[model samples]
Target: MAKAIRQIKQVDPAPEEWQAASLSAVVKAAAENGESLIKLLEIIKQLDGMGVLNAMEGLLQNRVDVAEIALGQLNQPTMYHVVKNGMNVFKFLGAIDPEQLQTILSGITSGFEKAAQSGGQESLWKLGKSMRSPEVKRSLAMMTGILAGMGEAMEQNHSLPEGGTDIG
Candidate 1:
């Protein structure tokens, strides 16, 4: 017990000693992560070149005013609607099947290319023939089905969970 107390008394560090210890630890860490340090320095250099550092410094200088402005903006109805719509869009995206969505996007791209290549207005008979195309009929069916489902969903009454916030 006496030896333990003696060791603790002997090791009581000054402020400068603490600072030196921290610097030594940091130096050791930098040596161990030299590659990571290089990459971090490169990222910092790019940010500085982009004037992001200056922008950050300015933001820090006027942090209180910036925060107040941000808070005021968030309180506005326009901001609220923007946030709500963004959230709903994200929710809708999450609900979609990614593979199916990709296929639909590919189809749209093909349609655009075909339209560009055609480069002219279609005759009345050609327009009527398009209605008989399997792809067109399939797309119309899918679109109508989606619209009907959405209409039904809109008409249905929904209840939120006990702790859930009102989405509206």
Candidate 2:
């Protein structure tokens, strides 16, 4: 019984592991060329203008339908990564200007709203095609890692006892 319990409690990759894998993928993709890196930066900047953190919050909240709608605009793996990394970078920079941040956040929220209204996947595909930058690819990889980490964390949280108390 003890062994079975331990097995059930075993960690599957863990958030850190997912993050590492994603970051490694990004680094590998980026090492190919400088132009790709520049493209990635541009994509990230666009995502930054789009309010990544709030979207991530929606994702973390288990608002699946809403999150899916918002993520529609990020169907392209590269676009996904750029926005994800942009959010991470912005979060890390505590001194970012408030007004500028608000504007970016508003734009992102509006973009999500618009995507939700448009019932076509073609736009997302086209956006991806437009973001053919190496840097964007790398950022996407890293963002994938961050998302994996978030998933792991969510899973771990779900497996825990309620009220932050020990079950046993």
Candidate 3:
């Protein structure tokens, strides 16, 4: 048996040696993932060719100014309303059934085509008679229903004076 060890000395690696070791590990990993490394290189080449890399580098260098400009634009009341209206539009669209919306759009397209073909000179009597048709009745019902629903939503969501003032 050997005598008990008095001290343990740890030798720190030189900077160059440490760098070489790290590079060797990276090389080994790149070898192991040759296909992925090639694909990544290809993407980098394409981005560089398109000047996207340059743009990104510039953006990174001036990120503080870019952020300030963006924040200033978004801080406006108009921007606030725009963002709010966009969200409401998205919500409204999401609430509708896609198939029902498609049907409605198709009907509107067909109606427009028919109206165009009619030369817009139909007499009031003819228009009144057309209202008796099932298609016209169906469309009118849909419009009135939409109006009623919109009225209900307005009443529920807004606290307007007797005759509403247009804030828009």
Best by the lDDT measure: 3
TM-score of each: 0.73, 0.21, 0.69
* All candidates: CA RMSD (Å): 7.8, 30.6, 4.8
**Candidate 3 similarity to native, TM-score:** 0.69
Off by over 4 Å in 2: 1-126, 159-168
lDDT at residue 126 of model 3 (Cα atoms): 99
lDDT tens per residue, model 3, 4-97: 9999999999999999999999999999999999999999999999999999999999999999999999999999999999999999999999
lDDT per prediction?
0.88, 0.74, 0.94
lDDT of 3: 0.94
Ranking by TM-score: 1, 3, 2
lDDT of 1 by residue, 39-74 (tens): 999999999999999999999999999999999999
| Model 2 poorest ten-residue lDDT run | 159-168
Off by over 4 Å in 3: 1-17, 109-129, 157-168
Q: Looking at model 1, which ten-residue stretch has the lowest summed lDDT?
A: 159-168
lDDT (Cα) of model 1: 0.88
**What lDDT tens digits, residue by residue, belong to model 2 across residues 53-112?**
567776688788777877786797889799899999878676667886786578668757
